[model samples]
Target: MKPKILDRAIVGASLLGILISTYALNVEMAIQAKPEYKAFCDIAEYLSCSKVLSSEFAKGFGLLPNESALKIPNCIYGIIFYCLCIFLSSFDKLNVIRALFGLALCTIPMCLYLAYLLAFVLHDFCVVCVSTYIINGVLTFLIYKKMKVLSAKKTC
Candidate 1:
């Protein structure tokens, strides 16, 4: 496959994982459910998905926990990231500029949440959740680079 195609495929796969991870997060939220995958939550007494999701940070610093935040779940962000991958792959077709911006826009909270997980709260790490975060971070960078390269090609 072409590099862009390959990148998009990777992003698509990452999104699917993100979707599953989001469901796991939801399960964490709704019950004392255990994550099927290894995670930061499985690490310690304070550092669990159940703890993290229900933490004040997960609750949006105590602002919009129950409403809009729920709609914008982690998996949905994965979907959005995948959509950006699709758009980026077709940059010779869609709004590459807006999509790049949107991808960065969507990731801010994820980066923050992931940051909090790694830095402050979780004494242990969940490998799958970390993988998801790493995927998103990489996708964001790849999409940005892809957009820049495409724009240059168009000008050329």
Candidate 2:
């Protein structure tokens, strides 16, 4: 496989993830600003971005709660993660590929955990969140495939 092709795939997936995360962050902000705010992502009672975004977990793990001025939305991390992936993809170094692979590998478990929380604990689904998870999965797969190709090339 061509490295350029893999780079494009990674960049494309990262950009899509960024867009989805941005939308989720906006919905989260709206929910915080107005208690009565209903986001379009609130498709149904069981499938509501508002419910998930408003939950305690949405603030993510940090020293300060989301109510604190220093706190940031969890989606902000997604945006940064995807952006970093995109940035890393610009380089053709094996180290860059390894970094991307490591980042993607780390994200898979987090996505799985969040998916479990949505399905069981939260009992609510955020379409935007799910979409981002799917994107992350795809990104990981692409990175793995790219890594395999790079390894093969290095061996040969």
Candidate 3:
């Protein structure tokens, strides 16, 4: 695909990620404020976004303890990541594109671990979580395409 097209796709995917993450953050806050609150994505017991979001693994990227200084909501991390991606996508430098590609690629392992938790530990499906994963995948692919296009340009 063309570099311009890939850039647009990356920006679009990153924007979507931002929106989803923001919504997830809002929902999380609402749930915290009122435990009885029902989110729009709370469809059923097993297929509930709230259930998954409220899970212990949803915080700190499931990597840090609640008391850890680095621990924060996963949605916040998503927001930061997508914003960085959008910022990085504005550059045409090969190194910048490579960095963006690397950043997007790094999300895959987190996605896999979250998927495992959703399926095995949490036993719940989160629409918002899954949507973010898909957005990450899209961003990764688009960034990769952009990297290849930039690399080709540099070689020529």
Candidate 4:
């Protein structure tokens, strides 16, 4: 019994996330080609997308020993995560909404952790990264609302 408006909102947020992540990914690739490339989001020394994307944590995990493989940007994960959210939200079933709720619950912590890393460890914040965080927050709120509506439907 998820509201159609809520579903559309979720999809809209997910699409925004995907778009930002794709831009970040392109920036990442551009940086790889020309190490001196400065992203448009590189506002200041302490607020640079290139600095954050070039950092050690930009990869899957800080543990990978191979430098080349570590070049993979974390925005790839964002794209996948948001795409999954969009796919789940497209379904009208209550079970799908519940699944999206669970996914959102899991992503909230990861988003917080990434924010912490950006603020503390990296001492930098990418505009694209912050945008994705905001998108995630919106998606989480929409998913929670949809879940509540579904639960009330079940009870009544």
After superposing candidate 3 on the true structure, give the runs of residues whose Cα lies further than 4 Å from its correct spot. Answer: none
Model 1 lowest lDDT segment of ten: 54-63
Residue-level lDDT of model 3, residues 25-141, one tens digit each, is: 998899899988899999888889888887788799788977898788899999999999989999999998898888888999999999999999988889999999999988888
Per-candidate TM-scores read 0.61, 0.90, 0.97, 0.90
- Model 1 C-alpha lDDT per residue in residues 66-150, reported as the tens digit of each score: 6664544454555556665655555543365446647655776767666666566654454445666676666666656665666
How many Å off is the CA of 85 in candidate 3?
0.7
Model 2 regions more than 4 Å off: 61-71
User: Which candidate gets the maximum TM-score versus the true structure?
Assistant: 3
In candidate 1, how many Å is residue 57 off?
3.3
Clashes of 2: 0
Residue-pair clashes per candidate = 4, 0, 0, 0
By TM-score rank, best first, the candidates go 3, 2, 4, 1
Worst 10 residues of 3 by lDDT: 1-10
